[model samples]
Target: MSEAESELVQSITTPLRLEYQYTAGVASTRFLRGMADGKILGQRCPQCEKVYVPPRGSCARCGVATDLEVQVPGTGTITTFCVVRIPSDSLDIDPPFVAAHILLDGADIPFFALIQECHFDEVRMGMRVEAVWVDAEDLGPTFESIRYFRPIDEPDAPFESYKEHL
Candidate 1:
């Protein structure tokens, strides 16, 4: 074919869709159930005594089985964060919101959560925050059970408290 004809035929556009189902493992099942009951559950590593939220069933560092269940408080500290200025089609929130890594109390690993109900500029490392849960009747086995983390009235956590996690 001529180069002109090849260039004309090279471009195409189409809509694509996919669907799938997921089965949760024992650790995930237990964690999801705890979320449904308005609780933050973690598995304790017997070797190191470090608690992991969204338990992985085994210690990544110690390589030991983690069967002990520990309930961590919804309160946490913001170890790090960023201001999201870009808009997204999937989320209803406006631009310039804050997203942060929260070191939940009693858990060794930190997890990501959106920050709301406060000015984005006020967000800072070591800021104390707490989960804002959905209505009781709307609770389910999902992370959405907790809408987002918000700054609390308590003083910010000391740097020494969360420096290792960062």
Candidate 2:
């Protein structure tokens, strides 16, 4: 094979190595408890009336301490997505998956998650999606508490549905 072809093959076949560790805080404990019950929790900003999922202890937008704990709807719309042709060592999923930015209903910002049980090409912006909760017994104080999101059978959401979320 030519040098260019050989380089391309090597690049495609080589796996990238990544390593990292995360330590949770006290606020995270409560968030995990909510997830164990199949609830999506968020911290609400009293000043701006915005709710953040995967709840942060403070409001970054308003730079204020937000203490109100609210339950956000699991149903949401896909704001954006990319097909994951490459896999990462930290990921628990298979390759060629779809990663998406979803704006849960009643949330102020979009959060990242995986989309599965559907075709990659078929996943699109503004598509309605719902949380696929993990098995109750398997729930934890981490993102793993909730499984991936799946495309809902509902009709395609209109452009106005998730445009601002982008």
Candidate 3:
């Protein structure tokens, strides 16, 4: 390397940090408020009639505004999932837990959530589950209001019921 380049490579390094805040828009505000009330709110697409949990304010498929509110049950089916065995500083969960894509009943798009109260090996596609929310006193306008999903006594959903979504 050139003498100038060699000297530059030996320069001391310093740490850089950035902090920021995020503002939730109208649609997301509504969804978060619903969570605070112990409700799962979704929006239905006027054109396609598909529902979305934690509404995006618009339908991705039809590219139309989704303003009609729909309240879906806490029950859903596990569309896909993974068994996490790696640890990370950001997550409080221990390893060997299941993380799954859950398609809430009445919603077209699936959302990510933690699976608990069952063995990781037993989690599978189409398994019926239900959200377990924090107590009313602990409820807040955050996704954390629903601690995690757990297996319910309902039968597994048929592949045909959610194949189109996949």
Candidate 4:
């Protein structure tokens, strides 16, 4: 290296640190408030007639502005899932759990959440599941208000029901 470049590289000794704070926008704020009240809110696209859980302010498909909010049932059908067998301290779940894509009743886009309250091997592509909320006392305006999804006491949804989601 050139002498000037070598000296400049050696002179760098401090590390950089910065703090970041985020403010949830209008659509997200409404969704979070609904979560705090044990509700799943979705926004309908007037043009496409599709509903989105955790709604964005605009439609991803038609690019139309989303303004109509709707409540969706917490129960949903599992579209697809993966069995997590690796041990990881960073994750809140134990090994051998499932991470699944679920389509809530009345919502079009599938939502991603954990599948618990049953053996990991029991999770099927079209299994019906329902949200398991944290106790009302511990609820907050955050996604953590919903702990996970558990298998409902119903038969698995027919393949055609969730085929489009997959």
Candidate 5:
């Protein structure tokens, strides 16, 4: 077919919609339950004695199933972050927010949390922050149970102290 003829042909179009049901595994269930209860949970690596937030289920490093549950505190240090200047309506939260990895207290590994209630420019690495939980009505067994993290009154962690975590 000539290029003009091919271009004149109507393009085949079909609307596609896909839905999925995600079943949280044992480790995730336990962690999400903790979030529902307004608590942060971590799994300890039996082999390495390292605590991982959200319960690694198995130690990624030592290749052993995690041992016990450790209660992580809401307050954490911002290990790293990215400031999104672009705006998108599909985002759960508004744009101009910082998406950060937080090193929660008592947990060796960090977890992702949105930084709200503060200016994007004010967010910094090693900044101390705390979780802001959703209301009781919206509470559930998911990360959404906690709204986001906000800056706390504590001083930023020293580079020397959190360098290893980075």
Candidate 6:
């Protein structure tokens, strides 16, 4: 085929789909209970005053066992983001989405999630975002319980807001 035709064909074709699955021990029943209640729960690292979402049973940084359960706020600032032009098998969202690292208010570390309800170009690295909660009836013991992050109406925060988390 001509070079132009080959390029056109490649662009038009979709990639193959691959599938896999694995079985592991069930996650903690307590963690699931937290998500169902519209709460972002984390395990605390007293040594560093750091909180971990998907609450860890132990602190990876300080190498100390953690048992405290902390509730992280839903509001956060975008530390960084990438305009996703390509869809991946693991992601449920459509293409041209924004994947961002959000530093939850009062949390030491940032959590990765999608930024929706705004144009990709309008999303900035330090934009303010708030969690759009899933329907109360739809709440579950999973991250999906919180649907996605949406732009906040508040004034843009200074770079200092989430700079260190990055």
For residues 1-166, write the lDDT of model 5, one tens digit per residue: 9888777656778989899998888898999988888888899998888898888599999999996888978998999999987888788666778999999878888878899888999999999999999998788898989888999999899877667787
lDDT of 3 by residue, 46-156 (tens): 998999998999999899999999999999999999999999989999999999999999989999999999999999999999999999999999999999999999889
For candidate 1, list the clashing residue pairs, or say none: none
> Would you list the C-alpha lDDT of every candidate in the order shown?
0.95, 0.84, 0.95, 0.91, 0.88, 0.81
Local error of candidate 4 at 37, Å? 0.8
- Estimated TM-score per prediction? 0.90, 0.81, 0.90, 0.87, 0.86, 0.78
Model 2 bad stretches (over 4 Å)? 1-23
Compose the digit string of candidate 2's lDDT tens values, residues 1-166: 9887767544445668889786666556667878877788888888987888877788887898878898988899999999999878888778889999999989878989999889898999888999898787887667777689998888877878678778
Candidate 1, position 80, lDDT: 97
RMSD of each: 2.8, 5.8, 3.9, 5.1, 3.1, 5.5
Clashes of each: 0, 0, 0, 0, 0, 0
Candidate 2 TM-score, C-alpha based: 0.81
Q: What TM-score does model 1 achieve against the real structure?
A: 0.90
Q: In model 4, what lDDT does residue 73 have?
A: 90
Mind giving the per-residue lDDT tens digits that candidate 6 earns over 1-166? 8887767544565779888674322234556678899887777787887877665566788998667788878988899989999978887788999889998877777888989999998999778899998899999877788789999997776888777778
Of 2 and 4, the candidate ranking higher by TM-score: 4
Error of 2 at 44 (Å): 1.0
Instruction: List ranges where model 4 is wrong by over 4 Å.
Output: 1-19
Itemize residue pairs with steric clashes in candidate 5. Answer: none
